[model samples]
Target: MNTNQKTIICFCEDITKEEILKAIEQGYTTANEIKRHLRAGMGECQGRGCMPQIMKLISQKTGKPREEILPPTDRAPIKPVPLGVMGKISKGNQKGV
Candidate 1:
């Protein structure tokens, strides 16, 4: 998927703007909990792309400051690297060479 067209909100995994609002209505106050319950940011990218948009939506809906919303967990593999790169690194390295 092209980066520009990609959305910070994931709609395909049954995550909708309304659903996020509903989760807020249900008192789920953290993005982590929302990720667990709604699977909105649980896809392959692991929510790196969608969390910001979700936060914006939350801030708008609840009248809460954006800073009050917890930031998303920043895991490794920042960019989606090809497995071929991993394979090359592994094969080219030798123990105690």
Candidate 2:
């Protein structure tokens, strides 16, 4: 690894500072926007680990307050699950469905 390389921001998604900077340069100013553009917060941890860092970066780069950079919209299945479990649920074998 290069000595000057930025550390990994999102371990689950393998996002780095350079990638986030590039996305910001491309006009993704908000946390949600950057997530969508770079898949930074869509990983298994669901941004639990890197959201604060991302928010800070966005705030610093865009001159916005940390509170102003909203977090990404959380969807159903907040926790990570095996793909096969989702397949079973989709197939209607889920207990309630």
Candidate 3:
């Protein structure tokens, strides 16, 4: 635990604790707003990697409770499927479904 090292909140996005706090200082008080500003929870893991910590930071900075923190809605597909695999799902091409 090197005290001088920046704490990484979002491993997928490489978002640092200081960066999130800076967003807070700039007046982005809510977790989702901060996520939007910093692109923190928009990475590959879709916020599972960072939203909780972001919520914690937001709660600490703004006196908001964790229960009240709501992460942004995930727009990406929950699981990725190969294009060819998806093509197999058609009525005539049900071979690989």
Q: Which candidate has the highest TM-score of all?
A: 2
lDDT, candidate 1, at 13: 75
| lDDT accuracy of residue 81 in candidate 2 | 75
Where model 1 places Cα greater than 4 Å from the true spot, the runs are 1-8, 81-97
**TM-score, structure 3 vs. true:** 0.76
The sequence of per-residue lDDT tens digits that candidate 1 reaches over residues 39-92 is 887777777667888888778878889999986676656666689986776688
| Candidate 3 error regions (>4 Å) | 80-97
lDDT of each: 0.75, 0.89, 0.82
- TM-score-best of 2 and 3: 2
Give the Å error, residue 36, model 1.
1.4
Residue range 1-97, candidate 3, lDDT tens digits: 7788989999888999999989998999887788788889777788887888888888888887878877677664655657786556665656654
Per-residue lDDT of 33 in model 3: 86
TM-score of each: 0.64, 0.78, 0.76
> How does residue 18 of candidate 3 score in lDDT?
95
Q: Of models 1 and 3, which has the larger TM-score?
A: 3
Positional deviation of 53 in candidate 1, in angstroms?
1.5
Ranking by TM-score: 2, 3, 1
Sequence-dependent TM-score of model 2:
0.78
